[model samples]
Target: MGSPPWAADPAPASRLPATNLLTIEYPGYIRDTSDSLDRALVSLSPVAGPRVDAASSAYALAHLTSLLERGGRVVECRLPSGSGVPDAMDLYKHPILGDVTPSDHVVVRVHRQVWKRMVNGQEERRKHYRIEVLGASSTCIRFRRMADYAFRPEMPAHASEHPTMKLHKILEEMDVAAMHAHRFMPEQEDYYDGQGAQRRSNLAMIPPPFFNRQELPFYYGYRQNPTSSLQTVTFASTSKRSRRTARKGDADLLDAGNDHAEVTRYLNRARWRNMAPVAVKFTEDGPVPTEPDAMLAQMALSERQLAYLERLKKHLSERPVWSRLSLLNQFSVADARALVQTKELFALVAYTFADGPWRDALVRFGYDPRQDMASRFFQRIHLRGKAPRAPTTRGAFKAEYGQASASGKAAPAVGDAQARPATHLFDGQHSTFSTSTFQLCDITAPVLLPLIHAEGPSDLRSAPDITTGWYSMSAWEAIRSSVSKSFHALLSEAGPHKTSEEAIESSEGSGAGDSSEEDE
Candidate 1:
């Protein structure tokens, strides 16, 4: 019934006064020997921001706290005999931020800590890579090969031996197996041979609630006819009349008001900062039967498919809103197959929408997509395994969506024109495993129509899920502890430990905290 040892006392937020020194506890460092390891630490002087005040009640520490909030895991590591100090440069960069190099020691530290967490009965829900070092003839040599890939040595197949690359290959094999398992399901075949099979594609936009809101922008609002399902309406403004009229037409019309703030913020960021993803194409093949799956099963010949496709022109027209289809156009066969294994259609679509075509598309359609904000969006989704609920208050919005760098300026946005949309993160070879994208859609039918047509109240249930919260609670606790112990100690007179009297009174309130990083 008591709190866990990992849990902090219900300390006052104002308990700590202000300080300028920022100390970062990096993930554990690697030991030279298999049996030992060292934990890295780096302290930043003259922390970024205005002059601090001692009377500011720990609030002035926000600048450093934000950075630490974005930092990686806090681990306790023991050093082996005569191990050198970890490079302070590595200590300064968070693993997720691309500051550290791929050395055998770093890889081992990452791997060992990851394995320890997994074996300790902690559940991992986020998508990531896992490197296996157990039972190898030589762990150092095996990891060194992995380091080659990590450091981008042009050693041909040797680079593939790197842990990151090897992990990617292992996942690739698993993905191939999954795609094969789902091969019998009805969908278009992506053939590489020049057999000249008629190729047709369709695209539709799944708005919020049904689609991952993290990926897609809620830009346009839809109005459905209550009298008949055949007629639909589209509105492009933020007004009460529009809302009232939309409700009259279809009570389930997605409330733009619900997503207005987030959409507006990103739209502004895109317009001002020019941080956008590639544009989504507006082309379309004619629509087929509303029941595309049923129609696809019966289309025995290319002629019948063409006939059904032509019939779709009556209902299908180019209604341009940012979409995931654009992103998918960039997905490689291997990537698609890999994503299919997770069977999380929402995640697949969301990732595509967030970075692929949707970012720029949102810009073209009157939204600002901040590269920094967009990066944060994807990172949190990866860490939390779900999107944060859009906060209701202006204060909540800043608190929830504020940048970790807290630089008071936007993170520089880069044009991904030369960047391959098919791959992201880690030398453009390893995609972020934060979410899954493997779903089979009948290329022969309307893709977004079915997703957009969810029935009843289920459509508006776009809030953060309870399952993701529970699974990620431990990670959140670890972060909270860092703030309490590290930052709090810096600002407060009381340190991370309790006195004898305090310990006895709070002895029952103790349990182990799961501080290990989640492996893919």
Candidate 2:
């Protein structure tokens, strides 16, 4: 009652007697096709069992199958025709197995077989199998005894040594000398001996920065103040290394020689690197008023700026127009510091021509290039050689200008007559004429000065003549035609002995016969 039959102790299992069984292995699958077994048995007989002829191979197979079934369970497994068992068996024919013969027929040894009972109370034995065939050729057939070799699973692939491991070892043993001797290292001797000389020659040809030490006259009086008081305090040495050494030794007896050398080296480097020109900052201290009076009242202009403005106006009044370089040259000689704030001072009294005949020239604000015949006279003329001698005699002048006017062309103006002689006299002395002559083109259109907002009688802004409608195409053409006529008449006055190139050069050198003095 306490322990039921369900909990009874389990009986010891009986062991089956061991039998010596021969497993006759086939190299591939065995199919149930007619003569399939007979052919296989005949081919395998020479290597596996007793030798049998083709006529008695079928009887030999039946006897072998019977003996195998008596000792062990004879199993039949019906595999699908598409099963890849035949292809897997082909792997055994590899050369690794030693002297494998190629066979059209594949053999498979039965390991485990399955049988099924049908619903109709019938015992079904599944024995049908399939094998791959290349062709019907007899030579394509292969035969082998499936021995202990076929039962061995494929040997695991051996792990290969990394390719970089050897390179790593070589690098570990490499020294600085070995690295320098390697093919990748640049040829140092060739670089320093041959290419170095060539490089130095090339560098010598290049003009050194800041070699032209001619100080800009405009910035003569302008001095940049040190940002901090510490900058003004000069020490024996500024270098970190020098100071460190000085602190360790007698500080009062610091070596001045090393400090001087350091300073020289720094100065050289600073000179080379300081290529950018000094820039003047024009600061707006207050809001700009539109009226001239209001601007004068509110503007934070200094006495120096006002004085410079008056000087610029005086120069402009005398000539009306001047090239930027010529103005600089004149101011540079007269008062080197006068144009320290050149751009700012010029903005008040004159406006520069951006392009056209008077390009780069500062014209007085009121002068209009469009209507001014003088502006048209200045054209860029490329002169190849030296200028011809000017006509010294009055007879020569009459023969040229007087006869040209008599031929119905316009006569040259009195201003033109007088100005030409003066330009000729100074043509040789002026550097402008030595290389190329610079002429000021007459102002035609009025230049707009956005910076100038003077509204009183002293207003610098030149009002355009709206009645003429200068903006119109017809008006523009008329202006252009008038300029051309005047320009041609002026050129005709040059003697026939002068070539076109010489005439052009002469006209440029003459400064369009304007009485304005040439820039010194």
Candidate 3:
């Protein structure tokens, strides 16, 4: 058979500008067919052409030049098979054998193979041809693997020897030092996102001495209004190097008078310095004070803390009982350290209920629950197994609770009662408490129980056992007596009046008994 058409001499290089030429390396093999060769040439055609103007062609050339400089690699080109020539092509349309001419600079090689295939249960002989275009060695780039010194050993050793033991020991000592240093380090301020999730701050990376040093403000003038006396201050960068670097571009534009623009206003200091620093004290024992007397005497309140205390007192005066989460949400204090400060201030005017109807809540010192049986705050209902299904309407709640009583099921324990409430118990006044507060308790603990108040059967009071339904009057009396004793003990520990006579006089002079009656 005669030599294939590609075996002929290559055509002269196109007269296009040398700068506009792009060299594409086809590293993969292509089937030596008329259609396959033509598709390859079509896919590799220069993106810029006669239809593209000189300006657009310049941009395309710059883009390709950048890609080549940045170590761009060859990507396999995918072309459609068994398709006719495009309508825009005026050249020979009928499968032109070797009519698709490439630049003479391109080098091509051909390979042939003989194979056997089964056709109609008979062995058939087949001849296969593949073509590969070899790019010039000068244009082809190869990347070498970078050496990693971290994994290499300074000294060679046998397989039986432990070469990494020294490195391991050093790393272990470093880890221990890091952990030990944490105990001595003061607590870092925490940041909070809009959703109230705690996030770590990077401010600790700054040196302590940097905060103590005062910085001078930088001023710059604009050329557009040179007579204007106002000088713009740079709030972001205080260093001379940064100021010089920032003004370099502005200086060029101003001297050239190319794009001189007027400055409207300087940066606002309040926006950048909005964060308030909270003082945190650390001791060898811990952050929390062990002795109440020391905490009351040494811990002086700041103006901000005193204002917060007054706001808290006003909230307590309006309502005798408030959940911890509700108070936090009201004040918008989400930080853990800030919450600790709030708890310390709260202890001065109120005390937490460890258990009972007011669990996880703070009751004002003078407010008593026994006299408020008619109030919804003092009411509670018991249910069996994980909290009842949330009822959407008042009728649904009545139906669910009423049916449970009719079925004669055993009452659920206090642990079960603490399960997430189906409906808002506080009339949706404190939305955050309804979801976050109750979930913190152990729902499976048999020893500790929760106090939940729900609108249920009117005859719930007749249930003989407190665990079966509502709490009895005797149970309330017992809770009142226990709470009174604990409150008094807390006062005696923190109050300045130490002697029995002084304590009696302090109580009588303050009219503690009269205040309780008035709060009721």
Quick one: best TM-score, which candidate?
A: 2
lDDT (tens digit, per residue) of candidate 3 on 1-520: 9998987978655343333234444433457697555555453333321221222324434644565677554321222224533322211111211111124454455888999989999999999998665543234322121211112122222223223333343344677764444322244343554466845332312122112222233346535444333334433322334244445434433322332343223333323221211111111122321122333434567887777767778877877666654554454312323555545676655554444444446666555443354333322222111222335434532322222333345753222222223322222121211231222121211211222232344423543332221444544343333222222332434433333334434545555431111011
lDDT of 2 by residue, 1-520 (tens): 4987867877755443233223333445667885566454543322221111222455545654563446432221111124422322222232111112223333333444565668678787776554332223212222231222221122112314222222232455766665455432222233233344532111101122222223223446764443312121124434456355333334544456543332221122122221211111112123222222223234456787777667777887787766544454444222423454345555556555434445455667666555554343332222232333345434533322222233344654323222122221112212212222344232221211111111333322232222221123343333333333223323346323223334335555655532222121
Angstrom error of the Cα, residue 29, model 3: value is 99
User: What would you estimate as the lDDT of candidate 3?
Assistant: 0.38
- Per TM-score, what order, best first? 2, 3, 1
Q: State the C-alpha lDDT per candidate.
A: 0.28, 0.36, 0.38
TM-score of 3: 0.22
Provide the lowest-lDDT 10-residue window in model 2.
445-454
Comparing 1 and 2 on lDDT, the stronger one: 2
Best by lDDT: 3
Candidate 3 backbone clash number: 0
Report how far residue 2 has shifted in candidate 3, in Å: 99
- Work out the TM-score per prediction: 0.14, 0.23, 0.22
